[model samples]
Target: MTLEQLRALVSVVDHGGFRAASEALHKSQSAISIAIKNLEEELRVEIFEREGYRPLLTDHGKVLVQKARTVLSQARDLSDLAQHYAQGVEAELRIVVSEVFDIQEVLRALRIIRDQYPSTRLTLFVENFSAPLEILEDKEADIAMVAGGEMFDKIEMTRYEKLCPVSLIPVVSGCSREQKDASELTKEDLHGATQVVVTDRSRNRDERKYGILETSVPWRVNDFLTKKQIILSGLGWGRVPLHMIGDELASGDLVPLSSSDFGPVEIETYISRTTNHPFGPVAEAFWNLIIQRDYEKTNKITVKLQ
Candidate 1:
């Protein structure tokens, strides 16, 4: 019935469960459940199936959620516009970023905006590549930062200057004798080596192409950073972002295996917003700041590396 309730419903659907949605919304699980229940009662429809612990959306629930999204989007636009007009600045901007982009850079950008804009509040959502795109397409986020691959036809995307492709180099800690030196690493080096893999099951489509993951023992991790940690602890060897492990590599804590590139798993960085969607002035200002930050980073990298 209320916009807040509508948002809670959509968040639950977006996150694929109640607990995740609760975490995202910063509300109690019971509060989220109550909001959805109240909305269902007001609409007189069984929006979600109660049979499973993770409630599945009913056919009618899907339709209402779509309608709710539009309604809430409009309501949010109105609020943003009113705040912009009254205070001469924007109220808040919610952005979703993929895991590939350095999280510290994003935080730095926000801090710069706080110093410059002074009125804008920022909310950051971090997820794997696919989830960020979903949030951008659904208009849930004002803007999204992604490490690009083949361009998706779903939304209008602006490619920023390409950041270093997150090279997925095989790495192992000093404790792993088999992976001590980069030159000693070879295709045969992987044979029987316990491999650590970072998987976002929701978005991983390479499983079919990779053919059955061959490992006598393997560790599956959800977070990319965790995968790096496991590798550093000598539990197993796995590919990691080249930029992420620069410090470890410098300190000899971890070493790359094989001089051959991992076929360049280049992750291009991009900033995207929905086509033809309205943005408040604060949103525009924040967008400019993001662009400026990327430009500065590119220039800095070029200078240091070149």
Candidate 2:
């Protein structure tokens, strides 16, 4: 079948109806119907059966569609690679990362790429981890750095060494460091303290449930650095990554109100993309740099202020 026919088939399966698929593909509804009919005839099977008013895929059709998705995804990647290749630079690599990663470290890596492969281009998109995964699925990003260990049928992950585990330590400014003890500190101790959380809408439900809340007033901040500043200024006590505030903690600018471990939050790093598409030279080269040396080693700094 032609690539257009395969594309039409995949779109119908994805959008779940010929009319919806037509609208999405910007083709007339009749054209979509004709494509599906042509596909069914070639395959000699009823791809769709009427179920109530909506068309449902036959069992055989479901199997065909599954394969069709991979075919279409790979075809699109081939087209993208070709277009990028024609542009004549080494290649283009697109990546997405979370704010939790040190931005400076990411910039340094790009600088090295520029010095080594002067013709190559690197595009970086920064967002929460979930958004990066979405980009990978849509094929918008060549590679994405996201939270690791979960497997999806369409995405493949290559593990990078674990960066520092984030510990959600509680902090309060102006609270007598002398009285610092986790067990002695209770929710009542946070009664008047303002609690700030980094604006991560997709954070685990357990994080929200276990979070310190002020029955009186709760503050939500969008920027992690700003949130840390607010906490250090003693506006309120909230969870801050231990690594991010090492200098402040050491300098007494920020103090852990309680010594109790809030437990380590595992944030494994990964480079992920669709398994069906092979990485072009640029994507491969950039990923190689990420794996060549441990990110933590290059990015590690004394968080504790002297």
Candidate 3:
């Protein structure tokens, strides 16, 4: 009936006995027992079978405990939301990052943010293709690190900062049957081979099959790392980010596959956020950090050019 009673019930169920629950809740054993007795009487149900060595929830008690947990969770969320508004700091910040973007830079930024805003919770979702954009549009993410292309133009962004262009090179395993140089291989040469592709994670969007040949059999994967591993095993050929496969290409573990039909694709990456919603303090700090980093990189490039 009350939050205290609910907490006492849940604690008793979780901690195994009245004594343990009292100890965990910092309440006397008598008080815990009294709370449970009052709750059972009010509900007109036996919450625990007294015959057992350890306290066990009765059938009805199990159902009530589940409901109590939901109520408790919602109550905590409400409290946190109030605290967030009062303090001007987000209770949680969600970021959806495209897998193609180098995660090392993002991780470093997050490490700094974690230390700066210890009260704000951070949730990172690594998705592929159009999923990051979709998540941002749906208000499921506070920010998105997406590869800018035609799909990115569809969304209206309040703030965005461009990063470096990512090069996607079509590659095959060095042990593959086709050993000719990349330029010598034609579209026809790769038509019969299996092409590994990362599936779009968006739910409703009509997925575009980039660089896929009509004649080639396509193998779909959810992430790029798996796709890269499949291509490295000689099971299939696929285009992966140059950053991810630099060592492999240098060591000749993976061979580049280019032809008149498909050679390499380049796309710009952006850190974007929508204007529909205002950012809390933590989110604002993170956005500023990303922009500062971009500015620093640009100044370095300009100095070198000068």
Candidate 4:
């Protein structure tokens, strides 16, 4: 019933007799006999037939020995896993990510972790802007995916490594800037229209602006998709990730701003550890995956505004 008893049984089967098992296991022969006796008494089965010079296993004894071998193998695996956990492997990891990442890249990382560390639990928190760092600093998250802007300036880069950059292409709804020629468009044209902005979802820190134009009136929203919906409604012009708005641009629901003079903004993304914080093995493995991801290059939003 116990692991010790199960191991004793397997050893006895492998070694041909109680005396041989005792020698193999470096235990007293009396102790081996007593363990086998206890196992038989507990299971109510005569395991060994003490018939001739060499002891032989009964039919039921053979079945139990096979079962005991499997159980003992699993027990050793459990012990190994326990040791692994004690050596900095975590039972769970928390990774907070910004809204603007390639879904495939995230899934690829998750799959690798699932395969490499099956027992480790992973929780993904999707937040926009500074919320990732807010979670990291407050000790809620072990790793954070943050935008590389003034947010990096607030935190020391010694604690972080560069991950990837997400392209934020400034685009307008098809209805806006109809009068301006694409090449001649300038700051004056953009200033004449309302600019949509997505607010940082951080509760702990003051929100910082990335690509907000100073001259235009700002329409602030909480989520990226909502901001996209607003811009699609011709509410305002705003920056969107090139990948997210590809279908919109293809279908003529949206187009890049008619401003050759306007900047092509790219939000530098980073995989940052909380300052002075130690990450578990699972989180570190995840961090490596982010670093190794060969991201497709970010292209500018040059979709002709029609």
Candidate 5:
């Protein structure tokens, strides 16, 4: 019914009994007991069953505890927000991005952020697929850019906006003609061909592929850069983000592959921030600028990694 009553109930459940709850909450056993009793009275139902040696939450109590935890979490978020505002310009902005975003766009935007907020620190985390979303959920990042497919169907976040579609191209090493030059290649044509694919690094998500043929040999790499290297080595064929392969494709170092199954597929990318945990001033400004940029769709730029 009240925060105090809810906290008391949670403490009792966590610590196993009234005596332990009293010790944890720094309250008398009678006060703890009264708090639980009052909550039951308010709800007009028993919250705990005392038939066993240790009192167990009634089905209702178990359900309410989850709701109580949510309330507590939100309450803490509110307090943190208040503290953030009380402080002046945020000292740092932490950003997590998936591999699909054009690196040039990101670097260009970083330059602008640096000029605008000279005193603020900028931290960038480059991850693949669902890892960006996971970092955001863990409160390790203030903002994230990820593939639209990486987002959960049921997600509650402060904000989300789709950016320009990122292009994906199927390519093979220039030398391996195993199935290259096929204008309309099929799963059967590419069967048993080694396919070097960028794999999801997060253990929480299921493995996914963009252009895998049913019969292609799968060679997994954790990042696009590594995948590009593997493909460039004439070891396998795979679909890679267009931004990452522009130079290779332009130089004929990688041969683009087309199939009856599909052509160049574009993935929708989104910028997301957590709900309730509002971004501080610097992060909000940078986020606004990132989403504002009119980035080139394909062949954006060739970012040479040092």
Candidate 6:
């Protein structure tokens, strides 16, 4: 019933005996036993079987102990949240990223954030197309890294920076009928071919489709990875990020299928915050980390050019 009683119950289960629980909690063994007894009486369940040298948890005790651990974790999180606010640190940082952007860079930035601010909860939503922007506009995300296109022009961002350019290559499985020895295939050749495309995760279904052939049969998927898998399985042909299909391209498992209308599509990706909402200390630090990484990358490219 009480947190102390729950703590005592969990401690006994974790440390394996009444005396050990007392030692761990810095309480007397009798006090620990009394706490457990009170908890068991209140719940009207036998918590422990005191038959062996070490007390064994009853079936009811095991279930209650798991629940107790969850309660204790949430209690600690509440305490941490209070402390974070007192220190001007954000309790949570949510980032909506497009799947086209390199995940390694995002993972590296997250690792640094995790090390620097352990208490700040980080939530990352990897979406395709205009979904990241939709989440940002809805105020569900703090920052978004999305691919730039006509849909991107509609948003007015409070903060914006170009991240990188991603190239989406039109490809098909080597085993597919569309695969030919010629360097290029015409639009007529792929008129009826099934094209796997990632569906926008946004509420706005009217968003214009990019790099899609109007005549091709459409097969919609939720993510680029799934789209790539479908194409690899010879189920369909579609455009995927060049970085994602590098190995498959090299192995000839996936063959590039370029036409007048279908070829490599270069998309400029950007990281931006739409709202003017003031960022907490942790969010500011994370934003700076991303900017710094971009700066370093630019400098490296500039140095090579020099």
**For residue 151, what is the lDDT in candidate 6?**
64
Candidate 1, 12-95: lDDT as tens digits: 999989899999999999999999999999999999998998889999999999999889877866765576678766577889
Q: Top lDDT: which candidate number?
A: 3
In order, candidate lDDTs are 0.73, 0.67, 0.83, 0.76, 0.80, 0.82
Could you tell me the lDDT of residue 244 within candidate 4? Answer: 86
Q: What's model 4's lDDT at 224?
A: 79
Return the candidate ranking by lDDT, descending.
3, 6, 5, 4, 1, 2
Off by over 4 Å in 3: 1-84, 152-159, 204-206, 259-261, 295-306
What are the models' TM-scores?
Answer: 0.70, 0.63, 0.66, 0.62, 0.71, 0.65
After superposing candidate 2 on the true structure, give the runs of residues whose Cα lies further than 4 Å from its correct spot.
50-54, 74-90, 114-123, 130-139, 150-184, 187-257, 261-266, 272-281, 291-306
Estimate, for each residue in 119-185, the C-alpha lDDT of model 3 and write its tens digit: 8888899988778888887667889888755566676654677876677899999887774565578
Residue-by-residue lDDT tens digits, candidate 6, 15-35: 989999999999999999999
Those runs of model 1 whose alpha carbons end farther than 4 Å from true positions after fitting are: 1-69, 149-151, 155-164, 201-217, 261-264, 296-306
lDDT of 5: 0.80
Residue clash pairs of candidate 4: none
Which residue window of length 10 is worst by lDDT in model 2? 201-210
Give all candidate RMSDs, comma-separated: 5.1, 6.1, 9.2, 19.4, 7.4, 12.1
Error of 1 at 124 (Å): 2.3
Each candidate: how many clashes?
Answer: 0, 5, 0, 0, 1, 0
lDDT of 2 by residue, 44-129 (tens): 99988976577888899899988888787778878876876676444667888766666665676777778877876678888664
Write model 4 residue lDDT over 225-285, tens digit each, in one string.
8989988887887888777898998887787764556756778788888544556678888
Which pairs clash inside model 5? 158-275
Over 1-306, each residue of candidate 5 has an lDDT whose tens digit, in order, gives 788898899899989999999999999999999999999999898989999999899998899888888887677688668868887677778899988888788888889888988888878999988888888876778888887555555456647777878888888788766535645666677789888877776855745567677687788878888888888888887888888888988888887777666578788888888876767778887777877774433224423221
